[model samples]
Target: IEGPDLISKLRSEHGVSVPVLMLTERRELSDKIRAFRSGADDYVTKPFDIPELEVRLQAIVNRAQGRPATRRLTDGGLTLDLATLIASREGRQLRLYPGTRKLLQVLMRASPSAVSRQELEHALWGDDPPDRDLLRSHMSAL
Candidate 1:
């Protein structure tokens, strides 16, 4: 049997959930369908872009780890998508600077649980720790 066939056997016999992306020279609708039916998460033909493949693998890892690919946070009708860094409130977008966007992402992910100022500070500024008032300024801006 071929690679796809072997993969199907592994899935059925071992109950493996690891994402599989089939990269092959075989390009046919039936081939692709068979791979998917056999438990492949993705299928890519030959001559594909490397960067795009990397993105797909990252998405698989993210899904396996239970982290949302979109990386979204919502609270009180405010929607923040960290992937695109778009923040919206009540279906309307709130223009946010990059720094403000980062601030909102951290805060929303920790929703229902208070994140210490120090934690936020570290998230925003890393080890350098910004001036004491900087975090307050970002919050106010948000």
Candidate 2:
């Protein structure tokens, strides 16, 4: 009937790896501790900021799923600088055009997961995409 009870039931019925974020009106320390001990991943009291709550939920899910918050992406000797939009391999900077950079960013972010051709096209150009198969050209450039 309560958050802790629900968490216990979920973990038992499902698995312990299930992520749980408890948002409740109970502000007491004892209540928070109890909820956590019963397997709640995060505790946010009422009157919390929406953005903060969203971030906390994302953090919990990331931890549960073993995915870190990605700023830069890297593989082998190649690296993609997310902030500066510079990509390099083995200390040598690789030239990337605007469209190619965008494609690389999207593809790297979705690494280890297959991305469909349609998704790549959507990322390159929203609804009004070019009528030609320009995605292949960008892929070649990247």
Candidate 3:
């Protein structure tokens, strides 16, 4: 089976919102554009200066950890403040468990489109998934 592109898989399939710096040997403009359009925060062709590469990587890291996008997502009567990790419905704060809150954060950010089970599993469990249907249980709670 053919797998998706690296950036596309990471962003669309894995729900990775962090900054990405592409260091590739390809120098074609099309490659650069494809990377950017695929959600790469920055791209550096091969034969890059060590110092410049370090600086660029650092810049992306700082940006990733710095102020988040001032985005407030809402649907119907539900409200989500991404920067604050707060969710409410009809102006009343919803008392959600920590895991549920985290789940909502992921869900709200992935709004208008269904988030893949792989992505949800990533959010629920970084790299290790319990043998049981733990993610489904948490989702059911929410």
TM-score of each: 0.54, 0.50, 0.49
Q: What's the lDDT for residue 72 in model 1?
A: 66
Evaluate candidate 1 by giving its C-alpha RMSD to the native, one decimal: 7.3
Give candidate 2 misplaced runs (Cα > 4 Å).
Answer: 1-69
* Candidates 1 and 3 compared by TM-score, better number: 1
lDDT per model, in order?
0.82, 0.80, 0.73
In candidate 1, which residue ranges exceed 4 Å CA deviation?
A: 1-65
The positional error of residue 80 in candidate 2, measured at the CA in angstroms, is: 0.8
Ranking by lDDT: 1, 2, 3
lDDT of 3 by residue, 58-108 (tens): 467657879444446688888876545567999998877767766776787
Worst lDDT run of 10 residues, candidate 2, spans 50-59
- Per candidate, the number of residue pairs that clash is 0, 0, 0
Which lDDT tens digits does candidate 1 get at residues 1-142? 8877888889999988788988989899999999999898898899997545755775787788998775567899999865466789999999997678777777887888899988888878889987889888999998
Q: 35 in model 1: Cα distance from truth in Å? A: 23
Choose the strongest candidate by lDDT: 1
